[model samples]
Structures are given as structure tokens and as C-alpha cells.
Target chain A: MSEIRRRDPRREWIARNRLHRDHVSVLAVLGQGNTPSEWLGPNGVMRRNPHAVGFIGPNGLKRIDRSGGQQGGPATVATGTAASDSRQAVTIEAPAFLVAVVPDMSGGRLSSHDRDLLGLARQLADADPARPGAVLAVLFGSHKEEALGEAGVDRLLHLGDDAYEGYAPEARLAVLAAVERDLAPRHWLLPDSPLGGADLGRRLAARLGERPATGVWQLEADAEARGKNGSGWRCTARGAANTRDFLRPLPRVALALAECAEPVSETRHAAEPVTLAQPLPVLLSRIADLGPVAVDPAGVALAEAGFILSAGNGVTDWEGFHHAAKLLGATQGASRVAVDDGHMPRHRQVGATGTWVTARVYVAVGISGAIQHLQGIQSCDKVVAINRDPGCDMIKRADLAVIGDAALVLQALVTLVEQEREEKRHAA
Target chain B: MRPDPQKSPSLAITVLVSVGCHPLTGRGRRADQDARGVELARALPLAEVRLLHAGVLDAGSDAALRGYLGMGFDALTLIEQPESSDVVPALAEVLADHPPTLVIAGTRAERGEASGLLPYLLAERLGWPLVAAVAEVEGVEGGVATLLQALPRGQRRRLQVRLPAILTVDSAAPAPRQSAFGPARRGQLAVHEVGEAVPDAELVEWVEQPARKRPKRLKIVKAASARDRFKAAAAKAEGGSGQVLDGVTPEQGAEAILKLLKEEGVLRR
Candidate 1:
């Protein structure tokens, strides 16, 4: 008897500890049939069985056998029905387009989050071949057209006015309402900025009488499906308790979350400049610009940082925390206990009630992970936890756990990093 | 520096409280928004405040409802409705009959179907301007109220909106004061029967399963080595083979960490 040996490339890939671009796609390739499959769970445990197949669930990857079939049946049924309904109900008249609302910063600069939205817009446009969509950017302040064009934007709708100087929600809403009417886009993408993106997105959704999906991290359009409603877009978002995937018809608005897509640098096409002819509604309220107040660089605003070193109640050495943060050039964060005990400021607290961070790497020291603290760092790419308790929440959720005192571990890390820097300096 | 009391009429504030429970524990308590709403009402001078709840009156909900009354309130209006009935229509009907200068609520409820959609839908139904994530009510003169809207990253925006508006309090609002036991036990739960009870259509079939942890970010390793394999195996273990520096000196522990850091490529030397 001949045996069909289909060796999964991911098994070897996982063994190497190399970075995979998309885990969901990997699961799709592996979890095809009744063949025995091996996969790593979110807790880093590997399970292998004949009945189990690698599946991408809301909470990440799971080895689902036939026994787990009943539990997942309802969620799939719900999404399928909704997708079919939305596809049939909405009719597309104008050319399919993905309009992104670009956020303008204090200076004549575009935020990384906004740039990511442009990249995503371009990706969505390229997905459909029948009527390849166009990507448009609604710019607020003055910006270089070349820079925006390079970030994969096909066209620029520049709104350079004195009213667009700061985070003016009302003025922005009026401008978006006018743009929506003029373009009548199939999908409206807004970057989930702390300044004004969320508010503007919700307000525009209400005005258009459309239900919006917020905190959307992943979106894909089903282009090859049958029926008019079958080819709608599917949006994945992180809800309060669980992650959810839903299908929405055309003319839907979504608030794009951070760290979902990388910004593209190469310009794919020439970006045409456009303008608005209609007058905007009068602003209801005026903002008083307070000059920039200086803040500590290593403070609690670590939401956008690529590297973060956070301390918990287990950390006793404040000096070590500061030293480690400086050595790694990472932002500083603290668990609720550390903030409550006066070891750190209230602004530096990371938890359910505090700031939600999406960093490339998060290093937790001396912090026993409370559920709230774990919730805040859900989007972190790599979590390296150093704690005394092996059974703590932080350790369980971390990709790497080093059992030791936080101060000692941080001190050692700082020392090694400093030595490396000094050796490089001498070589130079 | 106070405004003339005779010129400005006292503002009428109405607060909507919902049954609060711990999302994980399911244990009932006073909702966070209700407490903050009550506290905000207490801070306003020349304000007539009333507390209202629209839900079924049951033994399970009594404890949480009483918890709100414990905040020194003499009575709370409970609009009787079934568990499956829609509360928005009932609340809107009652508010229309007894219009107030301002309506306040928490950003969202903590219990079942906590969609955070009530405030937005209600505002649209009532044709009232909605202000969300308000930290404080700076002042109210004539018909305009100045509000301090809470933004992320420790930033605040001030805006003025016309009165007869709805405001949702964010976590930045002042914490509620302690609830007195005696006042809570003695407080009245007044029942009001108004509006039609419309049953909500249950669209999605809910299946119960043990909560699962979020999926780990997929890491693809390109380096192929015996040391890399060992490191990967160690990282994937449930009760990881982490070196516990129990009884070791801080210097020894530091050295072990330095070795690990270098092996992990977190530090280059």
C-alpha cells in the first residue's frame, strides 16, 4: 500500500521560528481535509491528531477535530447568510471605489496609520478585475501630492483650508458628507486615529443611515463568488469580548485599526488631484489652540511605539525600568497596580480602562498579567514576559517567558545592550 | 464671579441607569455609567435630577437596582418591561412625556447584548444632538452648555452644544462616591407602565463554549540551526522550561538573562 505523504511546509517553518506573513492563510492551506495536521495554539502548545485540522478562529489558531464541529457551525452560518443578503440587496451603479479619509497632523505630515489605509485601499482596488476600483484620499491640511501618490493613492481630494488646521470634528464631518455625496463610494475607510477619526466615522455613518464596523483590522472582498451579493467585502474586527467577522454591502464605512497593514512606498499609478465646488456648512464650535506642552518621552503614550518595555507591580526597581527603557529606545508602560501604587503615573497605566497599545514588541517586567492588562496588549506582535510566577496571566500569554526577578532581568538586558553599543562605537 | 441666579433658571437633569454586571463573572452591581451619571448630576448647581431604569423588576435585578439607590437617592423610576422587550422605545416615550434640559447615560451597558448602540439610535429617534465621551460639564448658560470631551493620549477638546441634548460619560468622568447601606435598603423602586413592549428578534443562535485565549501572531523562522530548534521548542512549551533563579544571587541571575538575550538575538554582541 502506498501512503500519500503530504508534508506541511508550515511544520518546518514553525520549527525555524521565522516570521510568516499571514497565519490565517497558512491555516487555510493546512486545514483542508481529514488528514492529520499539527498546529500551534495561541498559548504556544502544539497539538497533533488525525481528526484535527489547523483552523483560524477568532482567538487565533486551533487544532479543530470533528468533535469541535458543532461549536463553530453557528458562527459560519450567520456570516454566510448575512453575506448573501447584503450582496443581493445593494445595486452598484457607479464604478466600484474605495475612498479613504486621510488624517492630517499638526505639521504638513501624514500619519503612518493614514498611510496604511492608503496601502489597504490600493490592495482592495487590485483585488477586483471586472471593474478595478479606484483609491481616493480626502486630505485635510496641506500635503505634498507626490508623497501621498507614492503611498499607493490613485487620486487626491485635497481640502486645504484654515479650518482644517486642527482636529475639528464638525468641519471634517461637513466635508466628508459633501465628498460622500459626490463620489458615492462602495466602501469608505477611515483610520482609527485618537484625535478625530473615530468620531468622524461614527458621525458620517449616522448621517448616511448605515451601520458601521469599528476597530476593523482585516478586510477582504469576495470577488469570484456567484450572485450580486456574493461578492461583498468581509470585515474582521476586535470586539469587547471576542473578535468578529461580518459581511457588509456596498456603501459601508469601516474604521481601520493600526498594525493591520504595512504602508507601501512604491507609487503604482499617477494620482489625479481633485477639488470640491460646494461650500461647507458653518462650524458650530471654535477650538482654542493650546501650544504644545512638553511631556516625558518615556511616558504612557506608547500606543504607537514599535517597541515597548512595561513594568508591573512585581517590579521594585524604578531606576532599572528607566535604564532598560533608555537602553532599548523603547516606550515605557505600567500595569494598573504599578500606577495605583504611585510607582508610575496614571497616564502610563495599560489595561481595560487605560490605553490600548498595538506595538511590534512588548516586554513585560515584574508584571503578573491581570486580564485587563492582557486585554490592552492583545495586538502586540511579540510579548516577552519576565516574571517570578510561571502560572501568571502575562506568562501564559507571552511568546517567551523568563522566570526571574524583573529588576535583575532588566539590569542584565541593559548591561548586555550597552556593551554591544560600546563595542560598535569602538569599531566605528 | 458666580452668574446671577435670578437670570438663569435651574437646569433639569435626567440620568438613565442600566443593570451592571461584571462581564466575566456575571455578578450584578451598579453599572459604571449610572454611578458616574449620578455623580455628574450631584455636581451641578440648581439642577433637579431624576434617576430612571427601564427593565423587568425581578429578584436578580433588585440587588443591582438597590445599589444605585444607595447613592443617597430617595427613589428611582422603573419602567416595567419583559426581559426580551426593547427598552429604547420605552425610554424615549417616557422622556418625550417629561422633557428635561439634559439626558445623561454611560457610554455602554455591561451586560447582555452590550452593543453601545442605544445612545446613538435614541439620539436619532428623538432628533437630539448627541455628545459622547464627555469628561465634564464646564458650564451651562441660556441654552448652550460647554462640555470637555475626553480624547485618547491625555488630550481634551472643549465644545459648546445647544441644550436639550444627550451626553454619554466616558471613564475620564469623576468616579462615583460610596453607596450608603441604610439609604440603599430604604430607597423606593417606583414602577411606571408606559409604551408598547416590542420583543426583539433573536437573529443569531448563540452557542456557549469555554472562553479561548486570543490567537498568537504567526512567527515564521528563516534561520535553520540546532540552537534555533531548541529555542523554538522551549518557547512553545506550556509550562515553559524557564530557568528559575531561586536562591541565586542577582549577579548570577543577570548573567543567565544576558546569555538568554544574546541567544534570542534581542541583543547583538
Candidate 2:
């Protein structure tokens, strides 16, 4: 991966042979970003937030709800201070802008969860007012103004129109029409939601003549990082593959930078908002012109992801897996057997017929380290395994080994990460 | 293309039901247990869409016959089959006869074969696009019906295909809603006698095993008391502490122990 140099950043122009440089804007399909309250305590039990309405604490740790209504329950009742004066703002100066494909951010009867998500976006927007990005929230269905007004959208693109309801494919085509017209960004950002990213990514990639990678957390163009030689940022991602490719999960983070003199990360710009309403007429006229689509980007390249936490059968039990995953800010998954048992989705399954993942920090929890499973994840920069039996194959494969139950080790890890993060938050 | 402003096609989606066979208890099909079949029928923008409550059958064929009637299908056709080498052929027969626009089947039937092969085979035989793990069927348009395929990691994909397609639904599909017991009981089931009877294959041997359990093996035993947990940790510590070498070595060991304590959260700097 080429490094982004600040001194001589990539120029904004139509560089020769640069397919990516021509791209101009981005759209981020926003969803609820939540901080889970209860966790699996060290004792291998599900912990509830005591402040969470009626539930008991997760072991002994007192649940601190940011909203403060419940001590131990999952519901985050706001004390209201977090959003008391929040407003949407952006800080990037790129020719591009930020546009969020949001659900109904209008109307009066907003759900608490949507309210929190809006608050988060508002906070981020306010923190950086210099950026030109405007929030474009897509409402799910028909609703009156009273249903959306409070969610805090900079510019609302009401999708409740008859054509936009139903499947996102139609909505996407309309969105693309709008995108091509006003805010046609070179790249598009979508949440890795089960309901949205899977099909839309493939369809969009096909539409744009680009390959999309499903479940990508980060994306960038290579041109932003590499100099003139950069064509586009390589995308690193993991998804369900043939049984043969299931053992190893590809990197979950991807960067699709453009080819340019400067690195893409240096030019890393948040999504900006552009006018989508104007293109409706033209798109309506020419939609039939679109053809069959292509698949999302294949998980063939890992351009520049330094750290990753890959899980397999090793991370057993939903509770324990979630605990370890939260500690690392990592995506969670399972082995084929676990997926078969219905604990995790077959997509998150990692094994011979599952997703292939390789990262710098590869931690194997309870996975027995089968040859097929190992084959998929062996590309990781490092390997750490925790199992009750030291004689397991995973221990032999690991650069580090701890002989203990995966659940116990994960609990310890969660505590350590939380302690460190808490200290840092206080310090900040 | 603007959907015909005048008339939208009336599409009726039919879901076939089959029960898993018990060696002794026989076969029982739960057609009413199906909500997705109903949901898919509802998703169509047709004038009339109905759910077929196919009756319990000894084989996949038995269910298909009842499904044909319960769904208020335009016609009834029997799907003939030989000794059950597999139910794929029976399905093929029905699909060939009816040539229905949309055929939906459960990914797996709780049956003697219980193999989730019918949907895939049907797709291959019928040469229609098959979508598994479907959460929703958005709508059918211009000879193509749009479907919402649910992928792993909570991702959903939307697909559009012409009619005469087959979709096999997995458990991940939307949960079926409760049917009114009254209407379900009174629903008419017309059974068509299968004519193209294929000889049934003889079963050699059937091997059965217990269902697989989730792989969460790490068990953490909560201690009765915090002091007990501390004692257990102390007891579990393999190395004996405090070896005073009375010089440089002693200081190095002490520093190492303190570092370990700090790292483990037993001590905080």
C-alpha cells in the first residue's frame, strides 16, 4: 500500500488512465451505532445493566447508561444532556461532501434508538463544521413531517415516495440517478447491515463497473495514497465463499483509493451531501438503459489493514464472542459447525466452506485449529490461541498460547480493554 | 418502464409443505407453520394471492398435491415419482406441468430424506434463478420478480428475475405469522392423482445421529464470593512468589512480578 504524503498530496484533476480520479462524491448509508451496555462477565454469565430498567448488573459492575434511565437494561434512556444542543456539521474541505442515507429523521414519533443514532451523527457533524458534507437521510416509508422533524437531518431526501418504497434495488437505482446528477461521488459508503449491504453492494458495483466487497468497515481509493502510479485503493474484505475458501477470513477492512500522486488516506474525505432531487426526471427516462449487474469486489486483496481480530469456532457462545469482539472493535464470526448450530450466521462462519480472514492480530478462541480452518486464517501477521487443552493444534499454530478456557480468557481481555479505554477517556 | 398503468398482473404464490418423517411416528407436514409462504404471497401486487396449506404426506409428493389446492392455484397437476431416490423428480414433474411463474419451497423438509436438495435441484431442472436465505420478495416486474436475499452478517440483497423462477427459503427468511385456525381448517385441498409414476428406489441403509449442539465450550464458573475467586486465582498461580536472591537477581524478579501484576490488573500504576 502506498503511504499518503501530506507535503505533496494528490492533485484534483483528470489524470490520464485514472478511472478512480474521475469519481467525485460519496453517499454513506447510516445506521444506529450503539455501545452495548451488558457484557459477559468473567464468570461466563450474561451481565445485565442494573440501571437497565429492571435487569440486574452484569456480575458486579454497575451499568452506567449514558441515557441513565435504566441501570442494567439494554434500553438507553437519555438523560437528554447528550443531545441538549447537538447539531449536524462537517469538517472536510474536499470538493466532495457528506450525505447520509438515513431513515426517517423527520416526524415527531422517533424511536429512542434512531434518536441516539441521529445524536451521534449530529455530534460528529458539529465537531467538524469545516467539511462540506450534508446529511442526506432516506426515510423507509411514507410518513408525515411530525414523524421526522426531530431526528436532525441537514437535508432530507424523503424516500417514502411510491417508487422508493419496497426493495432498496429500486431505491438504489433512483439514488444512483440522483447521485449521477448532483452528488455523484467517486465512492459510496454503506453500513454492513444484513438488510442493505449484501445485495446493494453487488448491484452498485455492477452499476459502477466496480467490484464491491461486502461487510467492509473502511474504504478508500489507492490514488489517494500512492502517487501517480496509484490506480485505486485495494479493498480488503471477508464474505461467505465456497467451502474450500471458508477456513480463512479475508481482512474485514478495505481501502479503495484512487491513483494519484498523493496517498488516498491523506485525501481521506468524509461523505458530503449533494442535490439528489433534481435527477429524478432524467433517471426516470433512462432507467431501462441499465443492464445486468456484477458481483461485489472479490476478497482477493488486502491493501493496507494493519490490525484485525479473526474469530472461528474458538470464540464460542454468542455472549463470550461478543465480549471478545467488543474489546478489539473487531467483527465476530464462527466456525462452520457453530454456524450450522445456528448461533452465528452462515456468512460469519469461518471454516473450509466459510469466509477467509487474515489480519495482523489473529486471535483464535476455541477453534480447534483444523487444517481447513487454519488454511483460511494462516495469512494473519500474528496468531494467538486460547483453549483448555494445550495440545490442540491451534496452540501449535499460535505465536502465543494461553492454556485456559476461551470464555475465561476473553472475559479477562474484556476487563483489560475496558480499563484501558476508561483510563483514556478520563485522560481525554 | 412504467408498470402498466391499467392492469397489474394477479400473481398467486404457492408454497409446498412437507413433514420430516419419523421412523415410527410416520410423517407430519406443518403447512400452517409457514409464515414466509404467506408473506411471499402477500408481497405480490396481484389481485389475488393465497397461501396453500398442504396436508401431511408420507412423501414429498403428498404435500405437493395439497399445496396445489390450498393455494387456490389455477390448476391441479400430480407429480409422479418412482421409489424415493429423491423428491427432485416429483417436483420437476409438477413444475413442468403447471409451469407456474413462481414456485417456493422450504429449504429442507423434516422427512426421511430431510436433505435440503429439492430447492437446488428444482432450480437446476427448471433453469430458473434460485435465491436462498430470502427475507423478502419485493415485487415482480416486467416478467421479472424482485427478491430480497438475506446473506450472512445481517446483509440483504435484492434481486429481480423474470417469472417462472424458483426460490427456496431458509429458516432465516421472515418468520411466518399465525394463521386463523378457522380459515385454515375450512380451506379446500384438491389432490390430483400423479400419472407419470417413476419407480421408487429402494433404500439401502439409513444412518441417524443426534442433532449438533452450538460450539460454545468455554465455561466460566462464577465463584460464590469475591474472596473465593481471589483465593482461586492465587491457588491457580503456578509459580511460588518472593524468592529473595538478595542482589541484582532479586530486584529483577521483583520488577518482573510487579509488571505482571500491573499487566493483569491485579495492580494499577
Output the number of the lDDT-best candidate. Answer: 1
Runs in model 2 lying further than 4 Å from the true structure = A1-428, B1-7, B20-35, B47-86, B202-269
* Alpha-carbon RMSD to native, per candidate: 17.0, 26.0
Regions of candidate 1 where Cα sits further than 4 Å from its true position: A1-95, A100-112, A142-146, A192-195, A220-231, A240-251, A260-269, A283-428, B1-8, B55-60, B80-87, B112-115, B197-269
lDDT of 2 at B57: 35
Compared with the true structure, what per-residue lDDT tens digits does model 1 show for residues A222-249?
5532245453665555443342333333
Cα lDDT computed for each candidate against the true fold: 0.68, 0.45
Candidate 2 residue lDDT tens string, A247-357: 111121111111101111112123333345454552331112122222222221222222334455555566766755654544555666667767766666555677576
Residue B49 lDDT in candidate 1:
81
Candidate 1 TM-score restricted to chain A: 0.45
How much TM-score does chain B earn in each model?
0.76, 0.59
> Evaluated with DockQ, which candidate comes out highest?
1
Please give, for residues B1-269, the per-residue lDDT of candidate 1 as tens digits. 22355877778888999888766677788888778988898788887788999998888788898888898788999999987677888999989999988999987676654445567667767877778788788888878888877655444667777778888888778899988999999999999889688876431322223234434435554333454455676663233433344555555655665554444333322
